[model samples]
Target: MMHHLGKVALPVYFWLFVTWLFLPLFVMAAMGFRDSNFVAFPIQSWTTDWYQSVLDDREILASLWVSLQVAVLSTILGLGIGTPMAFMVARFHGVWRAILITIIVMPAFIPIVVSAIALRMFIGNFGIQTGLVAIAFGHAVSSVPFVVVMLLTRLNSMSPNLADAARDLGADEFIIFFRVVLPYLSPALFGAFMFCMLLSFEDFTRSFFLGSFDPTFPVLLFARLRFGFDPGLAAISTLVLVATIALGIYAERFTRKRTAPAKQGRLAASGDDKNV
Candidate 1:
C-alpha cells in the first residue's frame, strides 16, 4: 500500500515541480501575444505586432549585438585561461590540490554584486574604461571557475594510458597534448564554450557595473523596465528565451553526438584487449 502511494506521489511531485519551473515561461510567452500595451492577465485579444516591432527597435538590436560580442569574447578568454588551469589542477593532489581548487573557484562563492564592484575597481586601477572589453573581462572572470571545474571533471575520468600510449609512439609532449588530450577533451570544451557564452549573455550585475554607453541585453532590459514596459518587451524576452533554449538543446545534442563515437571506440578497444 505504501509502495503504491509512494509511486503515485513521486509522479505527482515531478509534474508539480515541472509546472513550477516552466509555468512562468508559458505565461511570459502568452504575455507576448497580449494585444494590450500594458501587461495584464486574461488577454482579451492576441497579436504579433509586438514581436514585429521589436525587430525595428534600434536600441534593443544594438544591445543584443553588444551581448553577442561579450559572449564570444568571454567564452574565448574563459577557455584560454581555464583549460590551462584545469590541466595544472589535474597534475596536483592531496592538500595542495584542495588549496588550489579553493583559490581558483573562490570567485564563484563571492557575491555577484560584490565581485562586480571589486572588478570595476580593479579595472579602474589599470585605467581600463568600462565598456565592451571591461564587460567581457568581467564575464570571463566569472566563467573561468566553472570552466575549470567542468574541464577538470572530464580530465579526471580520462585514462592516463591514452597519453602513455602516445608517448610510447615517440610523440612529443606538445604533440600528445594536441592529438590525444585535446581530442579527448573536445566534448568538455564544447560544453564549456556554450556554458561560458550563456553565462556572459545572461549576466546582469557584471555587465551593469562594467558597461559604458553601450549596455548588454539584460542591462538594457532592466533600464527599459524602470520606465514602463509593453507587450513588446515580453515579446523580445520570449524570443530570446526561445533562442537560448534552442541553443542549449543544440549544444547538448552536439556534445552527446561527439562523445558517443569516442565512447564506442574506447569500448571496442577494451574488448579487443580483453580478447587478446
Candidate 2:
C-alpha cells in the first residue's frame, strides 16, 4: 500500500507541477477573451474588444515596434560578438581561457536587477540619454553570454579534423567556415538568436532601467499593470506568446534544413574512421 501510494504520489506531483507552470499562462490567455476590463475568474462574456483596445492604444503600438527593433538589433550585435568568442573558447586552451569563459558567463549568473542597474549607471555616465541606444546596448551585453555558451557547446561537439582537412585541401578560412562550420552550427546559431531576441522582447528590468520615457512593451505593460489589471494587456501578451511560438517553430525547421545533410555525412565519416 505504501509503495503504491508513493507511485501515485509521484504522478500526482508531476501533474501538479505541470499545471502550476502553465496555469498562469492559461489564465492570462483566457483573460484576453474575457469581456471584463479587469482580469477575473469565471471570465465573463467572451469578446474581442480587449484585442481591439490593444490595437487602439498608440503607446502600446509604439512600444511594441520599439521592442522589435531593439530585439533585432541586439541579437545581431550578439551574433557578431559571440561567434568569435565562442570559436576562440572552443578551439584554444590556456590560462586565459577559463577567465574568458567566466567573464562571458558572469552576466547570466548575476542578478538581472543588478545588471540592469549597473548598465543604467554605466550608460548614463557616458552622457548617453537616448532611449533605444541604451536599451539595445544593455540587451546586447546581457544576451551575449547566452549566445557564446550555446555556440561554444555546439563548436566543441564538432569534429576537430574538419578544419584541418579543409586547410589541407587549400580551403581558406572563409570557405571552410561557410562550407563546414556554419552548417554544423546552424541549429545552435538559430537557438541563440531566437533566445536573445525573445529575451530582449520580454525583458522588463533592463528596459525599465535603461529607457527614460520610452519603455519597451514589457516595461510599458508593467507600468500600466500598476494602475490596475487590464484585460487588454492580456490580449497583448497572448499575441506575443503566439507570435513567439510560431517564430520558434519556423526557426527549428530552418535549422533542420541546413543541418540535415551535413549531420548525416559527418556521422557516416565518423563511423568509417572508427571502423578503420
Candidate 3:
C-alpha cells in the first residue's frame, strides 16, 4: 500500500528532477545541430557547420584560450595556498579548529558580486591593473576555500602514525611531506586541481570584474547574447558543456583509482614503523 506508493513515487521524483536539470542542456545541445542560422523550434534540417564555424571564429577561440590559461593559473595558486592552510588547520583542535575553518571559508559564504567588487577594489589600491593576472588572482581567491575544505577532509582521515613513522626513520619535515604526506594527498590534490579549473572557467562575475581588454568565454558569451542568439553560439556552448562534463567524470574516476594505492601505502608504512 504505502510502501508500494513510496517506491513508485521515489523513482518518479528522481527522474523528474533529473529531467528538470538536464533537459535544458539536452535542448541546447540539440539546438547546435539546427541547420538554420537562427536558433528556433523543430529542426527542419541538421548540420555540423555551426560547430565548424565556432572553430573559425577567432574571437571565440581567443576567449576560450584566455579562460583555459586563467583556469590553470588559478588552480595552481589555489592548491599552493590551500595546501598549507589545510595543514595548519589540521594541527589545531576543538574550538580553535572551528574558528580557523570559519575564517578560511568565509569567502565562500560572501556574495559573488560583492566579493568580485571588493577584490577589484583591493587590487586597484595596489596599482594592479585588471587583466589576465588579476582575473587569475580573483579566481584563486574564490577557489581557495573549496580547496581547503576538500584537502582538510582527506587530511582528517589520514593516520598521524604515518608521519610519526617517517620521522622515526630520521626523515625531516620536508622529506616526510614530500615522501609521505604529499603522496597521501595526491588524490585530493588532483581533484582540487580539476575543480578549481572548472570553477574558474565557468565563472562570470569575478572574471568580468577582474578582466579589462580580454574577456573570458563566459563574459564573451554574455556580451554576444545582447546581439541575439544563433546556432553557432549554441554549438560552441554545447561543445564546452560536453567537455566540462567529460572532464568531471574523468576526475571522479581518477580520484577513486588513486585513493586505493594511497591507503595501501600508508598502511604498509605504518606496519614498517611498528616493526622498526
Candidate 4:
C-alpha cells in the first residue's frame, strides 16, 4: 500500500514542482508578446516586435557573441580537465582518493559569488587582468568540479569487470577507454558539458567581476534591467529557455542510443553478484 501510495504521490509532487518552477518562466515568456514597452501582468494583445528588436540591438548581439565564446571555451576546458580527474577518482582507491574527493566536491558548496570574488582577487595579484581569458578560466574552474563529481558517480556505478575483461583481452588503456568505456560515459559527459555551458552562458557574477571590456549577455542584461523593463529582454529569455529545452531533448536522444549496453552490463553484474 505504501509503495503504491508513493508511486502516485511522487508524480503528483513532481508535477507540482514543475508547475511552480515554470510558472514564472511562462509568465515572462508571455510578456514578450505584451503590446507594451514594460513587462506587466494581464498581458493584452500579441506582437513579435520585442523579439525583432532583440535581433537588431547591436549591444545585445555583441554581448551574445562574447557569451558564446566564454561558454564554449569554458566547456572545452572543463571537459579536458574533468574527464581524466573523474577516471582517476573512479578507478583508483587510496587515502589520496578520499582527499581528492573532498577537494572536487568542495567547490559545489561554495557560492558562485564567493568564488568569483576570490578568483578575481587571486588573478589580480598575479597581474592577470580581467577579460575573456579570465572569465573563461573562472567558469572552467567552477564547472570542472561539477563535471568531476558527476562523472565520477556515473563511472563508479558502471561495471568494473568490463575494464578487467578489456585488460585481459590485451587491450591497452587508451583503446579500452575510447572503445569500451567511452560509450557508456558519453551521456554523462554530454550532460556535464551542457551544464557547464549553460552555467557559463548564464553567469553574471563571474562575468561582471572578470569580463573587463567584453561584457557577456547576462551582464548586459543586468545593466539593462537596472533602468527598467523591456519586453525585448522577455523575448530573449523565451528564446534562451527554448534553446535550453531543445538541447536537453537532443541530449536525451543521444544518450538513449547507447543506454542499452549499459543496461545489459547492469544485468550481467546483477547475475554475477546474485549472492549479494
Q: Highest lDDT, which number?
A: 1
| Candidate 1 deviant stretches above 4 angstroms | 267-276
Q: Candidate 3: lDDT of 159?
A: 78
Tens digits of lDDT, candidate 1, 84-175: 99999999999999999999999999999999999999999999999999999999999999999999987876777788889999999999
- Tens-digit lDDT track of model 3 for 1-276: 889878998889989999999999999999999999788989999999898999999999999999999999999999999999999999999999999999998998999999999999999888999989999999999999999999998887787898897899999999999999888898999999999999999999999988998999999999999999999999999999999999999999999998877767666655543322
Tens digits of lDDT, candidate 2, 1-276: 889878898799999999998898888888899987667889759999888888988998999999999999899898989988898788668868888899888988889889888888887677997588888888999889889988987676677688888899999999999998887788889889988898898888888888878778888889888888778889988888889888878877886676667667676655544412
Q: Assess each prediction's global lDDT (C-alpha) against the native.
A: 0.93, 0.85, 0.92, 0.85
| Model 3: lDDT of residue 61 | 96
Off by over 4 Å in 2: 1-7, 249-264, 271-276
Residue 9 of model 4 has an lDDT of 87
Name the lDDT value of residue 85 in candidate 3. Answer: 94
Per TM-score, the best of the predicted structures is 3
Task: List the candidates ranked by lDDT, beginning with the highest.
Answer: 1, 3, 4, 2
- CA displacement after TM-score superposition, residue 45 of candidate 1 (Å): 1.9
| 3 or 4, greater by lDDT | 3
lDDT of 4 by residue, 84-143 (tens): 999888766898889888888787788878988899999988899999989999999889
- Report the poorest 10 consecutive residues by lDDT, candidate 2: 267-276
- Per-prediction CA RMSD (Å): 2.7, 3.0, 3.1, 3.3
Each model's TM-score, in the order given? 0.93, 0.87, 0.94, 0.85
